[model samples]
Target: MRFSATALLALPLLAAAAESPYEQYKAKFQSFLSNFGVAGPAADKASAPATPSISTGKAKKKVTEPKPIHTLTLDNWKDTLYAPVKAEATQPEEWLVLVSGRNKTCYSHCLRIEAAFNESATKFAAMPQSPSLGYVNCDDQPVLCNSWSAGTGNLWIFEMLPAPAPVDIHYKRLNLTTVTSQDIVDAYTGRPDIQWRKFEGYFHPIDGFFAKYGLSVPLGYFFWALGAIPSWAMMLVVSFMTRTMMNRRMGDANRQGNAGGGAAPRAAPPGDGRS
Candidate 1:
């Protein structure tokens, strides 16, 4: 009778937990997601309640799974892509792209964007399981700049996990309120929800090719010059050989004409008859 009553008492709790929403359970991480603008209003509303709680009969050892293949932001985003990381690896590796130039041509907004990227990148690079950071100087290397779909004076974030792993890499292009130091860092780390645009890389387009291969305009020219130098050299050699052959022919003709036109043939015949 006691066991029957106990089972009856636990029935409502089980139903409540089973009926609760999934986001309500991940309440701990929701605030951070909201701040980063990753999870939007629906998530914001769902995070009030903690994760579902169901009675398991006996105490189970708690095990937390390491988050893997994260692009696990607000769930809906502008652009998302995936690549595989190698099997044997050491630490987390990621990238953030700053699509701007350093020359005199770089505008005021470009400089500001770079500053924000640099500031956040530095801090991110130093953290535990931190990611490596890099950028492009569009003035110096324009070929690859178009892939991120960000024009001069904007930023693009990339998370590269090159080492071997069971999961594929994820890339998220996020949007935010403004460009400021640590703004990108915050964007990457996860914060309040913000409106973002997706990056569309195209292979048919010039910029798309560069983005797909991570190449640049200057690099293309360098490759062209490599092949061109050899072609030009071959042409010069052929021209020189033709000139030498023509000069030899002209010298031979001049000698033959001098011998034919000279009075030497008559004198030689007279001397030989006298001998």
Candidate 2:
């Protein structure tokens, strides 16, 4: 086909218009801009600056802190209980303390008491006013027990106050020998001048072990026997194995000696015997 230079240039532009969407749009936009007497690039730049910026001014929420729970210990006993009572001489807040033996020795009862008192304390603390609840180790703090008329491995209630003297403490023993967590809560919340009966004889060692775990006497003995059986069986098996190994070694030694003795003695030298 024959074509002029201008026509060939027009052919490339037509091909671009057909193949590229951007070029086609630009050509149409430039036509509209020429009709309106506006430059395409400058108009786009001027329109960009006309868009408005937005501000929300959103703020983050603040979190509230929780209240702390208090439990009595040897270190804090003086500061939380004794010091307060001593400082406030005539009028002092009521304090509940459970005195028991060393944790290792009386862990079961001590743990039960502690858990109960902790629950009671949490409940009481929610009220308008609540007395302090605490635990004391009799072994660690024998003097405190004596001063408060508390015996080791037993729960004691005391009313403490600051007097003209060093301290004024009154003991209030409960009537019941065995007390639960609820019992303590009731006693603390209820009457202070309640009558108390003397505790009977202490429990026997075996009886106490079973009682502490809330097991019947027969059941406790059965479990004890059950625990002992495995140890006894293991000891018997070890003894039998040792005896068997020893007997096997002795038999082997005897067999070797007998075999050596039964063998014929070496013959005398042939030349010496002939002479």
Candidate 3:
């Protein structure tokens, strides 16, 4: 039969020759659905949760703070203990701070003592560690001084006047009649080390010129002397001494002529008086 192009195309699709058109159409529809994933229920239920439920055996932990340590003192503070703290000032109201051990720090302790140790006119003596590692200010009302170290522990004793010679303040053997450990700790409204005892009897602060040699005094002297000499004057003195030493070693016999001494006296002219 005579067929137009459209009629021929539609006739074959509708008639189906070697294979069934319906079956081909079904296969193609399934393929398209699979490519886009619209064909079946979503892949297995989103994988089961790795852990269905958490265990309840573990519990939260609590934190604990460190306990304060005991305060150690020297048995014979005046003799056994030797340090720069003795050079500190002495006053009934003044306080002394002692810190030791490499990791030990007395900043807070010193501040608290300063509040109780000072009077309206009290003053703080210069400490060896001052102007560098640390310093004290009696005028600050709450004067704070501290010692930090990683090697040997330092004993610091605060008094109303500067420390005595040999420069050591031992708290252990104070005449336990006046200032006891409890007295001091109690005054500060805190509990210090357990070995507190009241020092009784006459406790006089020692004084002597040797006390001047304490850390602060000598340090000051060194700096003062260092500043007194002018650069040129120091250079001249050093040069002169060096030359003197060198001349003595080299045995410069001619150097005497160049020096201020006059030339050897000429032999008296043969008896001028004879003429």
RMSD of each: 26.2, 25.8, 20.9
* Model 2 Cα lDDT, one tens digit per residue, 32-131: 9989888677545656766576768876765433223334443465466655465545655666666665553354456555555556665665557656
lDDT for each of the candidates? 0.51, 0.55, 0.37
Which stretch of 10 consecutive residues in model 1 shows the poorest summed lDDT?
72-81
Alpha-carbon deviation at 26 in model 2, angstroms: 26
Q: Which residue pairs clash within candidate 2? A: 89-162
Off by over 4 Å in 2: 1-82, 85-90, 103-107, 146-149, 152-157, 165-180, 193-275
Name the lDDT of candidate 1: 0.51
Best by lDDT: 2
Count of residue pairs whose backbone atoms collide, per candidate? 19, 1, 26
**Candidate 2 overall Cα lDDT vs. reference?**
0.55
Model 2: per-residue Cα lDDT at residue 12: 79
For each candidate, what TM-score against the reference?
0.35, 0.37, 0.21
For candidate 3, the clash count comes to 26
**Candidate number of the best TM-score:** 2
| Candidate 3 ranges with C-alpha deviation above 4 Å | 1-93, 96-157, 161-209, 212-223, 230-232, 252-275
